[model samples]
Target: MRIISLISACLISTAASAEYIRGSDYGFKLWEGAAYTDDESGQFSHCVVSAPYKSGDTLLISFSKDKTLIVGVANDDFNFDINKNIPVTIYVDRRQPIYATAIPVSSTMVTLSMPNFDQAMHYIQMGRTMKIDGRQFSGIYDLTGTKVALERTYSCAASYYDYASAPVQPDAPVQQEGLSKTALFQVATNMITSIDVSDAKYLSEAEIENLGFGAASVFWQSDDLGILAGTLTAHRPTGDLRATDSQDLALMSDFCEGDFASSSQKVSHVEGVSQRELRGICRLDDSETQIITTKTDIGEHTLYNIVFFLNTEKAGEVKRAEATGNIAIHAASYAIE
Candidate 1:
């Protein structure tokens, strides 16, 4: 399954007709939705950047606390090309060259296809799959400009779970047999339970009365097992669904250089997808781990090592906006082999 998004930054030298990425703000009209198709790879994606999408819109660009950099154009701007053109510089460790490029993406997102290449590419995270050189992965790719700033791309693997068929029941219960208790939670247990997004309950009356124009997923216990219910929120862009699922598979990592710091302490984990650091941590045991990886985005970026914990538990109750902004890990009992 392609569980990541990619954002690319290409070196664009400004000629008379070429766009420059100086202090220019390629404003956008906050496109309600924007889509990007990668030229080198046949991967395509869409997103609804934060608010403020308009022409000449300005947004700050910087690397994660870890010193890892990504290209971004906020103000709800999108499309690698279409609107404003900013500039930027991409830097990598032990790398040489102040590669430069204008942020080809317009601050506003519209359907687009762009060409990108990096002679001096930075090695980010890489290992999120069973070891196989020919295998594909899904994650984000942040291409910082040699001088300008643009929004990031939510990149995914070229060959991902094909949803071309009608969307599979996100709540379908998948079963597998022949597993030991020790390794059950690793993959089957979690996914078996996660096949569904779960059910919801408006605890208080106010929640139900004021419930409108919002997206929600509620996981409750139908007996001892788990049942899920999801509601699409109103007033949100049609892009919300894309983002919600994209985030689950977003290839973009919040990369930086440094130790886990008191600064941005809350943001600890992130989904890494750069060729360099893609296959970061090794799995201790696979038969026991369903998706042998984690995604976090808080804390200092310069940590010598990053650790994410995944455990299993019963579906007592699971709520969004819960678990301290961290992904909620619920309990799932796998079918006995």
Candidate 2:
């Protein structure tokens, strides 16, 4: 069971007027006034750290198992809309300004994802202040105690995954069915570079030209979940491609950090065949993106993966539809035949 840490209940604040107190869990620390929600179930479900600005605005850093490490800016008096993408730059100490995009979480709050927590934390620890400059809003945040809070948040993530505490398990082979080894390895090196918009039933048709599948390993829409799919070949015989595929996907998924919230990775067996699946809910502006990745053994020394890019709002009901798998499966099955 997870226990949401409440180091000091009296430190909790119901309003922005409350004096910010110092709070810590694991090893990270943050202003008690900055934390907006505490699950209190012996598990750290949500860890939000914020700071007040001279303009009475609020800057926030939120950590959770299902969302990314996000730094948000909120102002009650501002007429800002989180539905649109707002470009911003972060200036730490005298270092070069790092470019980022802030998506709205509410009418007045906008957040940018911290893809590299270590780098951001390093800046916060040694820098005097962190400044955010957007098209219509700007704020300077104090870095005091930010290092401790970041450390604690990191600890919470490590613990949530049981990374330090759990023992490693040996790789296991996926259950097999009627298909021959040759037929099972379906992924090919030369993949389809361009797909017609109408052919992509699961993707947004409006983004057809702009969303062409480039050779890059990842793809994302400003308002949708990112999609990443590729094939990996083993130089030598690796008896269990399922384990290898799952591990690789895990590493890629963890790169976003907050993608682990409401995330799950497992192997499901059906009709004597096994498929490794990874699914997660990613927080977006006023909405969420759902990422689903599934892998299957197809050919000699090869494994095939199908990664999905879907929005919780639009594709919420159709994610499980057969159309999503029809393209990948029919193509693979035909190629092998």
Candidate 3:
């Protein structure tokens, strides 16, 4: 791992040059180093550089993780110390949620929400571009470390409505338990944001996916019950490549308890099926929320993950789906879109 101050590092362009991964957007990996990591809290946090630049430049922001925010810059890591006497309102990340603004200097205190927006906002254009030290970013890549490209359009996203029929409260936090080692390893890498399935898309009529795979995304938008979105991709592992993912809306609607044995009863009969030795469930208000990711070598097993959502108005528990040993890899958290 290499760390250089903005003044000492290699300077490059600021288009969209992150090489190892695409999109320096928040909740993603940029360049080659670690883009996702675990802090003291169980919550997954991600950091990506806007484009390597100086402190004098502007940093674009966006929304994510329900109401989480993304604030990227073109400089090295550092802390900003503003006078408390000036002005104060919780500065959000344009992508996250915040209780109330405060006058503090710390990572946790920094709100990820810029001002508005959530996971469902889909109107993409450009928005406000504030300075690193409170000015406008000249849109230049001041530093270089793999030539991360600078962004041209800044965006904000969110969606909401009268959420009354929700099986679960939209904003309620779910308790995470029974995290599998595979899932834990993924969570440590902040892979949760990358798990998704596809609705099947063909890239070429003359050709099929090398191994029948592609890309997908799950954003803050609820499927009316929860949050999920699936798609097909022509991109997947080819050779000895190894990866793990967590699909948010991998749903299995209904199944008879008698369909499986007691040994297979990993969760509630109505909560769908879980195979691996590990699984978790959360009770959110009158509804239930669950998260499970694991691996095993044996016979067939069925697991389900549901994102029962109605647009962005209501939420419900997601059903789980059983997976194949190889296909379960899609459950990994680092697959690219």
- Candidate number with greatest TM-score: 2
- Count of backbone clashes, every candidate in sequence: 99, 22, 73
Lowest lDDT sum, 10 consecutive residues, model 1, at: 297-306
Using all chains and alpha carbons, the TM-scores for the candidates as numbered come to 0.24, 0.36, 0.24
Residue-level lDDT of model 3, residues 107-201, one tens digit each, is 11222223343321221122122212222112222232121111211111111011111123678754222323344333322222333322212
Candidate 3: where are CA atoms >4 Å away? Answer: 1-35, 41-43, 47-49, 54-67, 72-114, 117-337
lDDT of model 1, residue 199:
34
Model 1: lDDT of residue 2: 14
Ranking by lDDT: 2, 3, 1
Q: Model 2, which residues run further than 4 Å from truth?
A: 1-30, 33-44, 114-118, 156-337
Best by lDDT: 2
